[model samples]
Target chain A: MLTRRLSLFATLALSLLLVSGAQAADIVRLATTTSTYNSGLLDYLLPKFEEDHPYQIQVIPVGTGKALRLGRDGDVDLVLTHAPAAEKAFVDADYGVEPHGVMYNDFVIVGPSGDPAAIDGGEDATNAFATLADEGATFISRGDDSGTDKKEKHLWEEADVTPDFKGFRAAGQGMGEVLKMASELQGYTLTDRGTWLAMKDKLDLEIMVEGDTALFNPYQVILVNPQRYDGLNTQGAQALAEWLISDEGQDLIDAFRLKGKALFHASAGEKIDPTSAVHESD
Target chain B: MHELMNTAREALHLLLSFDPALWEIIGVSFRVSLTAILVALPPALLIALLLARVAFPGRWFAISLVNTFMAVPTVVVGLVLFMLLSRSGPLGELRLLFTQRAMIIGQILLAMPVLTAMLHSTLQSIDQRAWETARQLGAGWWQSLWVLIREARFGVIAAVLAAFGRIIAEVGSAVMIGGNIEHFTRTITTAIALETLKGEFAQGLALGLVLLLLALVLNVLLGVMRGRGHQTVSI
Candidate 1:
């Protein structure tokens, strides 16, 4: 009986290996931020991309920092993230190539309906952060070094307030988890508009601040440098990256919506900023 | 290979230097797991004794149920607890979600089945004469129970150690319920999970080493207890 079981297990393992090996040539590993995944953007976009292409894109959703690190370590073929400064550093360091703006969104500060910090309807994110710190209002931070986390830290710095206050919590989690935590704790948190629109119904929080130019979040797709790594799916990576910025891809991004509201603006070929070296079409 | 060596060296440095953040995570793990085990021990022992001694109806069913619960994944437990303690759930008024207390509760539930199953087997293996003789000598029920437990002391200790090992190493429930809040609910396993996600391998490796050392220590203790038990039985 034991011999029979062993043979059965070996056969099963061999079949699994064969199945994976069959598709290994066409696999494109894309590491991206959790916001994009949690917001259900990739779920809507990848299937359409796969319909036309020979490659099957595997999405690994993590914090932006880890996504870029995966690109740097050659663990992934492509990275889609929103932290522009970090993306610039990654490309400048020769870890990634052909950075192109794929889409744009904005971050908003959300808080409980009670508005304990009284930051509701605020246009200035930095000033609102200052108010939250002054009142010692509970604030949940995505401490995972995600794109949203980096933005929150930047706002805190601009507000000239140390986030080490009594009611500040650094939750090392994703955007969805942080939003849920903020609702549960009745705290304030910074979130991208995509995830906020997707999860706002279930959350008891309200958008307290928006429309700040500093809150602009732009996403980019960059290929892992083929020169630094061997065995990379450079062809598939380039295909996906180029396809994302094509007219058809941009149109799909513009059409994708959550709750009957557009979540991301297609910004292919647009300059992220005057200082950024990421324009592909110009 | 070179990067791996550098990370390993950094892990060792973090361990030797006694980094505050690393130690804080270790502290959370011990505090929460210890509280959970302590809270679970007494009821687990009682249930085990009842299952082993009492000839109640559905006794076999009860034993099967416990063994079934023991097989349930930790994440399933976390999911159930998360739903119950969520703001929309029935127990939302208590507001216990995403706290160390909630983690302790999840760990207690996780620890109970293992504790009861192991303890039941240990109590079942004890000679029936030990319980009967104590009672016949006019010792009260509690005293008789105590005598029975004393006879299987090593097995009971082993059961506790084994359960501790299971719960301490479990990451699924702790991450889901504890929320991995820094300096609050972040345990060793959750910290490692977070660090790995953030692409910081040194702290994760350091905590992984701590857990490995803990597993080694528990196994050695179990071995010692087994040897002592054999010596006692031979005598």
Candidate 2:
């Protein structure tokens, strides 16, 4: 009886795998950042993409560095990440095709309600960071070389602060986990606004600083160069790329919201200026 | 075959270099899994003894429940823990999520069922006369319980070893609860997953080889313990 039951379970599991396996053959592998994956954006976007597109998307969420590395290695057919400089470098090196701007979001500095560093009401992210460094305020960095991490590093450089203070921590993980750590420790962190909005209710941390032009973050989708790697799914990559910048995809991205506030602004056809000013007057 | 050779060469280099990053990952894996097993050991043993010796009403059901848990996928355990430890969950106030403590808790949950179920069968296999004889000799409850455990010492050791094997290499719960923070919660398995996703197969393969070596060492220890158990029983 035990053997029979075990076999029955095995058969069920195998059959399920087989069903999914049939669909897996038509899968289009896309390497993306954890921010896009964790904000529940991909979960909302992929189903719509699948309904119209011929290929199924298998989204692998990692750091921006890793995502670009995957593209360079031809491990994935396409890449969707927010690190514009790295994306540009990858395309410039001919590892990937030209990256199309998909959407734009801004980063926010979130911390405890008391706002220990007095960075609140500041439009200058660099100045706020410099003050945090000088005060030795407990700041948690994503530290994973993610797009958010890159922005934080850039802000530190712009602020001319070393960020080597004793209170600074590098939680080398995704954006959501860093948010949780910031809430638990009451430390400050830089995060993409979409993820911040999605998880704000559950966390005690509040947006302490915002509306900085330096905080602007944008996302891009690039097709991995098929010429570099054999067995490359160029057709699937092309189709997905074309569909993303299409009217339908832009509409879907524009329609996505959290807590009645739109998380991202679609910028499919336009060149995104990284230093574009965010709405501070609101 | 060429890829395999290259991976083996890389694995050897990583192992020989005494790489701090790799060692740190190993340290996290050992620290979490060892602490989990130690926390789980006493309770699992006591429960196994109870289910083996006591004439409880729901004893059969209890045994069946334990056996059922043995089949629970690691990912399901991870998902359950993730929800419970997330900022929105009931335990959110504790703020234990994304910490080594949370991963330890998940590993404890995972190890308990395997330890209890395996040790239960070992306890059952011990002769009932061994307990009777201890009692006949005026042995106290604690003394007799110790003797009974000694009788199944090899089996208990094997059970502990098996539990360790199940958890040390588990990725799902570790990644889910621990968040795989580098220099913090990243274990060998989580690191391997990350490296493989990044298309760095050499590092992933090296980590895989280390896991395989760990399993081999554990099996060797189990074999030695079993031999000693046989000698003691014969004498």
Candidate 3:
């Protein structure tokens, strides 16, 4: 009788787990950047992650600012994004627990086949922006606070003269949509080369200019500060951060490529020395 | 001041231009929101109609369930659906996770409760004699239900407006389920969120303006409909 009663209690506990499991997800919400998402890197890497990790990874790819904000608000378990300036500020502000290097890619200036701004010469990013602004080329700015947009604005500031061109346009959309619109309108845009390469098959645009010292784009993965927010899922965020920095995760990043060209260079364990190039020195 | 004014003017021109990207983002938002609302409306109205007119074993419990769902947060709904659609979980074979369909499923769930509860209240608050009059006028059971629906038209519209408002503005479900992918699954709210994160507030601001326009249009449409509804009711 004692044994029977114990078995019944065990069965009841198991049933409770089953019922709750049906209604609740054991997934971790990963807020990240559109570049990381639109490139199709997460879809390739996350299955391996979920296979090894206990929780399913539910990715919410937005802008780095929003991804970090989601972390700041403890709305998501982890963040994968670029834009070192914003990430530094986010880390300094104590919004995210710890930001770790995920990968690096360069931003490219893409434009129509006709090269309307004449920004086609292989000049650096700052010069290209100056030329585009000078020509008032129909520039499609993301207008969204995405890492790419920030970098574009930074380039504009670096080039002293802001262009007074008539054809400036704000897409206020993601990298892919902006690129597609640029293609349709035969305009110019700044995009992370990774997304551009992945979406190249769908566009009539070409890389107008690249090889800018100011074009280096670095990505990082960070956990939300669990201590600050009561709703923070500490274990899940920690798991995501730890996983992205692991050898397997870095390998996946290295393996991620589009059209036989590597999209992002892995930088997880390397020290990012920031002293190489400053386009605008005060 | 001159340069600043020039920059401001450029920004304004950027916003006002009939940029295809602007229309594209709004188009994406409308497609996603309309799909979510249309997918949700039938079930929501059915549940509301049942809750208002029918007496079931769990009548109060059903009402309470819908009320509970009205307050249920979007992320929570995304989380719940994520579980059901994940590979290791049951119904995993469908592989519905991270698709626009999955996002719609999430939004449908999010919008349904608010729609149902609002509709139920509307139907319940209607004059009881209206249903009786339809019934006595040789209308069959389905005809009476249709007349009841027509009589509660304004209330239904209000519920629809509320559902659309709630679903379109929601970022959590769109991000979690739609995965906020560009070119395919991205919506205005999700795009705005991503843009804001990247500090391209201009892009976000543009999307924000569109979203605001959408909200204003919804409000105006509701106002016009409500006004017409009231005028017809008096007649």
Candidate 4:
């Protein structure tokens, strides 16, 4: 009886696997950034894609570093992420092909509403950063090897003062998470505008300083190098990439708004000034 | 401080409230680990019996190899499994990565050797007279197998329980192979890692408390089993 019951269970499991295999062609695997996942972009994008296509897309969103790692491992069919240098390295390594610009956003400094650092003035990003260092105000860093974390580290490097003030907390988390930590601690933090705008309703923090050309963050979508991983779903990935670069997709990106505010601008084509005003404004 | 206290109180409320996700996680943990043990147990017991009762060449070397696997960490198990299951890996065509089956495979690899080593000791400790008496009483080799199995049932059960405890609580194997995808492979430990990263302390604390309770409850169950075993032995 025990052996019979066990075999029955095994048979059921085998049938399930068979069913999954029959639908393998009806699936596309995507690896993307935690920002894209946590920011609710994939949640919004997937339903539309599923409605349009018979196949379901399974998104595996990790940190930018991990997303690239997944692509390098050929664990996913496509990747959507930021981190220009890392993306370049991936493409150069022949792990990804045909990388395209997806959207544009910027990083900003947010702090307690009380302005404990008195960080607001017609001050440049470096001076504002120096002010925070001088006041010894707590600042939370998203030490999670993410695109945002990379940007924060770069900005601190540019400030040239090695602003390692008291409470230099590296939380090693996502943008939404690090922002919440900042809110709870009422400490200062660097955040992407998209995640901040999405979460601003829940936060009492104010944008202390932004307008920095050096803080512009861009997102890109890349199809995995099919030659590298023979099992990659190249046709489906290309189809998705074409849709993203198409007029309808670009408009959808431009149309994605949060709390009566636009979060990102389409960066598919058209080369206008990229944060040149930020330097002049400062 | 008040916020922290409020959050802790809320966490307790959610835990006692029997949230659906909590139970789903517990069920998944039990089902996966249970399936893993059930799969590993037969082969493990067979090997243990063969190693203990059968005389064969290089049997000691085989036993040593199994013992060596007993010390292999879950992370290494996960890495090796990831390669075996990934798209570019040797078994890439299988596409088992991020699936529950892959998790079970990891768990089986995780639990089997430990189970074998444990049951080997259990069988070696069994009185040789029990099997000999069963055979003398007109029992065949198969019947004597059952007789010996019954005699060492306590230690066997303990072996299974310990293996279950190990896999159910393991994080590295679960995350790497299962991917800890939400509403999918997110076991208790991986979920705790994510929640703690999000600084969602109430949820994190609630999950941690549940994991703690599970450990405590399993320990109590083991103690009771031992107590009951001692009583059965005396009887």
What are the per-candidate TM-scores when only chain A is compared? 0.88, 0.87, 0.88, 0.84
Kindly list the per-residue Cα lDDT of model 4 for residues A167-255, writing each as its tens digit: 57665456775676577557898887878888888886999888776767778788889988687788888878778778878888788
What's the C-alpha lDDT at position A276 in model 1?
36
For every prediction, compared with the true complex, DockQ reads 0.55, 0.19, 0.16, 0.02
What ranking emerges by lDDT with the best candidate at the front? 1, 2, 4, 3
Candidate 2 docking category? incorrect
Ranking by TM-score: 1, 2, 3, 4
User: Number of the top candidate by DockQ?
Assistant: 1
Please, what is the whole-model Cα lDDT of each candidate in the order they appear? 0.90, 0.84, 0.76, 0.77
Model 2: CA > 4 A from native: A1-31, A34-62, A99-103, A116-118, A131-140, A159-173, A184-186, A230-282, B1-11, B75-95, B132-140, B194-201, B223-235
The DockQ for candidate 1, computed on C-alphas, is 0.55
Please give the range of 10 consecutive residues that has the lowest summed lDDT in model 2 chain A: A273-282
Query: What's the lDDT for candidate 2?
Result: 0.84
Top candidate on lDDT is 1
Return the lDDT, model 4, position A177.
59
Give one clash count per candidate, in the order shown. Answer: 0, 0, 18, 0
Highest TM-score, which number? 1
Task: Give lDDT tens digits, candidate 1, residues B1-235.
Answer: 8989999999999999999999999999999999999999999999999999999999999999999999999999999999999988889899899899999999999999999999999899888888889999999999999989999899889889999999999999999989999999999999888868888999999999999999999999999988887776677
Candidate 2 lDDT, A147-242, residue by residue in tens: 888888888888888878866877666788788778866889999987898899888898888888788878899999988998777788888888
Which candidate would rank higher by lDDT, 1 or 4? Answer: 1
Q: In candidate 4, which residue pairs get closer than 3 Å at backbone N, Cα or C atoms, i.e. clash?
A: none
